[model samples]
Target: MFIDRAVIEVRSGKGGDGAIAFRREKYVDKGGPSGGNGGRGASIYFRANSCINTLFNFRHGITIIGKDGEKGGTKLKYGKYAEDVYVDVPVGTVIYEEKDHKFIGDLNEDGKIVKVVKGGRGGKGNACFKSSTNRVPRIAENGEPGETKRIILELKLLADVGLVGFPSVGKSTLLSVVSAARPEIADYPFTTLIPNLGVVSSKGGESFVMADLPGLIKGAHLGKGLGLTFLRHIERCRLIVHVIDMGFSGRDPYQDYLDINNELKQYGFGLSDRKQILVASKMDEEGAEERLSEFKSKVNEEIIPISALTDDGIDLLIYKCVELLKTLPFFPLYDSEEEILDHKVYTLEDEEPEFYIKRPESHLFVITGDKIEKYYKMTNISTDEGMMKLITHLRKIGVDDELARMGAKDGDLVQLCDFEFEYFE
Candidate 1:
């Protein structure tokens, strides 16, 4: 199965919680806080693998979670950091963020890697808070949560030349004769369902990759027939070999040429602008010469005549393709600068408040925000000193003032995530 696209869920590992402990060894007159910091979480990355040709393995939505870091220990024993996860995908695969449809990275080259999600940072231990004023601080932080995202992977075939035309126009036949590839071919239309790749070498030792792509119908650009399913494969082709059936299919060769080129123009992505070589295929058939002569009169460009079955004019076609490829420039599947600018950017000035107060019911207040939620998760409120330290930090951030502004009275109920507390002025 030639699976070109897939959607998968990926998650980074969570950091380990900081330990809150004090020295209790013998002969120790004064024992201060000795809690160690938590370990960092594992990150998720995507690497390119040249060996893989398809994304068939990732058909179902798979969640790739990184290993969680070990918890901190007493006596300043830091937790162990988890290893990062690296996923291997086919070369020329493009990754996109599913939610926003933003371009994440393109694995155009082998061994190319991009960080998909960053792991959460480890929390600080109580030892980090100890100072001249507070030597026996009891506060310890919990581990931070990792990032989760749904990403889409799309594979684009890398080929030097792409053969495109209506179905059964001798594309598969041409590929089979010119190279070692054995694509399924039959007399019926749409026989070549999947894109087939082959390597053709000239007599002068010049070689180039050629792809026998799926046929393009009139409404192919609008997703009719093979449609956009295989259109992406053509984007990488430096040269397009427009294979036309000369009076064989009883279809007008000129009209077929116009329809196919229109589809390319509609699809965009610089495909219509690429240099094309016109080929009047199946030249052995009767009336093929007359049709070719007429097609030459209507079309201003040069058209090569070839018969894949008899091996007539095949060698010259290969030589012509190799020569043309040398002068053609490489076409990129995506614009790097445009994709980079499309990604979300953040500035310090755009930062929101640490917490926001919401009154869902009378005598009830809710506080929520990124910074506040992180602090709330890290707070070890079981200890009185820890709870006081958290309260002091909340006050410093104007959470108390925000609550008062929202008509929060003394002794009222306040909620932070799942935790609830009695408000006090």
Candidate 2:
């Protein structure tokens, strides 16, 4: 039930259509245009909630849609704007666009909100186009279309310290003894399939969140034994508590320590460089002291020996974590400037072309672009005035000139989206 990743579809609401009406009062000699403008569409937003800990609510591949605006009323009344939609996700959730895998935003704190997609703008009424040169305009625009997108949500547990080691190494046992989290513990490997979180309060009144991640094997970086599924969870951890099983008869404690460090180095994300506190578990077991001595001799760093069952050295471990946390700063998930820039949104205003021209056939020319398509969708082409407006926009944007340069002749076909028309120069 602890789902951390999900793919969902989201859509924003469309604007309401404009109303075309005229005054027919008995006392009025000449009635003017009294059309009303359409209402605005709803926008979609994602909010972070501290009470939620997983992405399970969004695992069912649901499609979320925002509310549409109300239609415009008669007597020059403007339509009502739609209410925005908000989605609640767990803290530390990262969103990305599914099509190109572009990073949208990171919700790492509680109550943080991000607007993922914007709704379409409402169209104008015939009264909006009334001018002295062309009084009593009869054209009314249609409503704009909504935006649809498929996004991916990934959850990374936000913890001050992370418990990492091989399976059955006392990581979960230590967590249960120090905090209220009761993780499934067993004698076999991979007993803790999912990550577990607990809050540990030191004797000095200092508290910090700790996470017990799943076990890791030799080839973990190469997709062996849980693989990258759980390794990503370690990226946000500020401190790593490496627990080594000094009592395991078949395994060498020093070798285990070296192997786990190698996996962290290979996984990248600056995990190997992260601050660590070495813990030797099962100190009460027979022959554990001898192995601990050997591990201490091989490594110059200090290691704390603790027995979870007997509560020996647990206070020292907790105090050491709190002491070190005061000096250590939070590590960013993205370290390099290039990585940060890649996640940002940038606009290429003057560099990119407005539209592209493609000729699939000698008699047909296809025009495609984001701006052109948007205008085509919002224009009300049923009336002559609307059609003339679109034609004027196309000419102003150099579409007509470009077609003429391409040897387009009269009666030739021009395509924009699904609509096709004959060119007349």
Candidate 3:
């Protein structure tokens, strides 16, 4: 079973909580805060492995979670940092965020790696807050939360040449003859469901990779038959080898060539403009020569006529492909500058507001934002000093001023996260 696409959920580890212990040595007097800071959480990364060819390992709706960091220890002993996790995927795998389909990364080369999510920073201990004016601070911060996301993985086979045509066009047979690849072949259409790759070597000691892509039908760009699923695999091909069935009586050889080219044009990605080599397959058939003559008259490009069963013209086809590949350049997956820019993920660090206030009712007010929520999660609010410190920080950040400007009166309910308190002043 060849699987090329999969969706999985990944989560980065959470940072360890800070300790709030104090020294109790007999010789020491008034031992200040001795708590240690927490360690950083584990990160998640995706790496490309040339050995793997499919995403079948991740097809079972797998959920990958990074290891959490160890908690801080007493006596000023810091917690241990969690190890990062790396996942191996096939080369030419493209990842996208599931929610918005935003492009994440493309692993087109072997050993290529991309960090999908970074671990959270560790929390500070009570000793971090101790100063000349303040001693024996009892506050300690909690661990930072981890990040979770659903991502989609798509695999596009990388090859120098891609063989494309309608079903039963002797594409698989040609690949098996020219190279070691033995793709499934049958008399019916859509027999080859998955793409097969082979390394073809010419007699001149030149070699190149060839892919036998799945069959394409009319309206394939619109997802009619085996659709865009296999068409995307063609994006990585440097040269397209269009195989036409000269022997088949069900469809006209000339019209077959036209329909397939139309599908490639409609699919975009500069596929229509890419370099191509036309081949007439099944030349040993009774009316194959007649069909090839007609196809050549209708089309201006040179077509190599080959019978895969007899190995006739196969050597010429291989030599032509090897010679042509030496001159053709590799096409980038994204064609335009705008398309490349669209894949980049931008962060609004300074442009976004620090916090926002929402009034759900006449007597209720809610404060919510990423920055404020992060501070709320880290603050140790069990002690009076910790609670006072949080309140002072909130006031310093202009939360109090914003509420006052919004006509918030004393005794009105003010909520931050799950905690609700009465507005004062």
Candidate 4:
């Protein structure tokens, strides 16, 4: 259940609506609007938790939503704000904007938190819009909508050195001897299915992390053996430890080294650029001296031959790894603010008001926009009072002028999206 990658949709909360009320005290006569404004919506954030190692927590989830803000109250009392939502992930977890594939955050340090989505701002009440000329205004704004996004989370294990070789090359055994990591060891190929990490400390008390990646076969890049699954886990490593079976009893050590290198090259993810160390494991077996000499002649570099069972050459390898760690820079990767998104609210008032006219059988009209929809949905125009209210609203929004410009007459028929009306003075 050590899942490393997941895709989930996230939505921030929407702002609350503004309240519309008037002062009704007995002592005060004709009081103005006393309504309160709405509260702000909840934000969405992502926090890094060191205790976690996988993205399994995000499983079984397709979307996450934050709470909406509370509505405004009377007597100038503002509504309560919604609580923010938090998504926790393990260290080394990278957040990417799935739509654009942009990097957002790198959870390198423990307890680091980053805001992924900001909540919508609350709308103002009619009371705030009241003026000396318009003291009894009955206008109020609705709540703003929240932001929605789709993001991808990926995890890469952070380590100092990565051990890579062909199957059954004693990589697990080397790690078991050098560090405290226990990996499944056997004679068969592809014994290590997953990457195993270990912490190796030197005599100077300096320590570094090492990972035992799965064995790579000749066609690893083409889905052979472990395929390219374990190759991705080693991209974050600083050094590559080439553990060849210097016992050279079964295969040529030089050819094995070249074969693994070629796989990394084919993968082409900056793995070959990393610092590599030459170490031949299983040297205790007979006829190892001739193989070691031949391998040295071919490689022409310093090679450490180790016998993991006898605990020989373990300390020297640890020391060499530590020394290499000191010389290299403390390489750190970072993410920028461009990974997140900005939230915006859209309202009908801001849209272009357009109405259509057609003569399918005869002349007909169709109107669309913020004001017309409000008159259709909120007005009960079957009654004379409702009809009067609709006319007053339409006139206030300049609907009559628009109809005249479109060549409408007293006998013409008018329509607002789905409603039809006979024109009159």
Q: What is the TM-score of each candidate against the true structure?
A: 0.86, 0.85, 0.84, 0.71
Name the regions of candidate 4 deviating beyond 4 angstroms: 6-9, 24-30, 54-56, 62-64, 97-102, 130-137, 149-152, 218-223, 249-251, 266-269, 285-301, 327-425
lDDT score of model 1?
A: 0.88
Clashing pairs in 2: none
lDDT of each: 0.88, 0.88, 0.89, 0.77
Worst 10 residues of 4 by lDDT: 330-339
Give the per-residue lDDT of model 4 (tens digit) for 38-94: 778888988888888888878765788988787777777787888999878897788
lDDT of 2 at 112: 93
Using alpha carbons, what is the TM-score of model 4?
Answer: 0.71
lDDT by residue for model 2 (259-358), tens: 9999999988899999999999999999999999988889999899999989999999999999999998877667443356534455776455778889
Per-residue error (Å), model 3, residue 416: 2.6
Q: 24, model 3: CA deviation in Å?
A: 5.2
lDDT, candidate 3, 128-222, per-residue tens: 87888889888888778778989999887788999999988988889999999988988888888888899999999999999998899999999
> What global local distance difference test value does model 2 have?
0.88
Per-residue alpha-carbon lDDT of candidate 1 for residues 1-425, written as tens digits (9 for 90 to 100): 76788999999998898888898989998988999999989999999999888898899978899987777889998988889999999998899999999788888889999999988777778888899999998878878888899999998778999999999899999999999999999888899888888989889999999999988899998999989977878988999999999947989999999999999988888889999999999999999999999998999998889998789889888988988988998777663334445456799987988888888899998889988997887777877877887889988999888888777888999999988889887
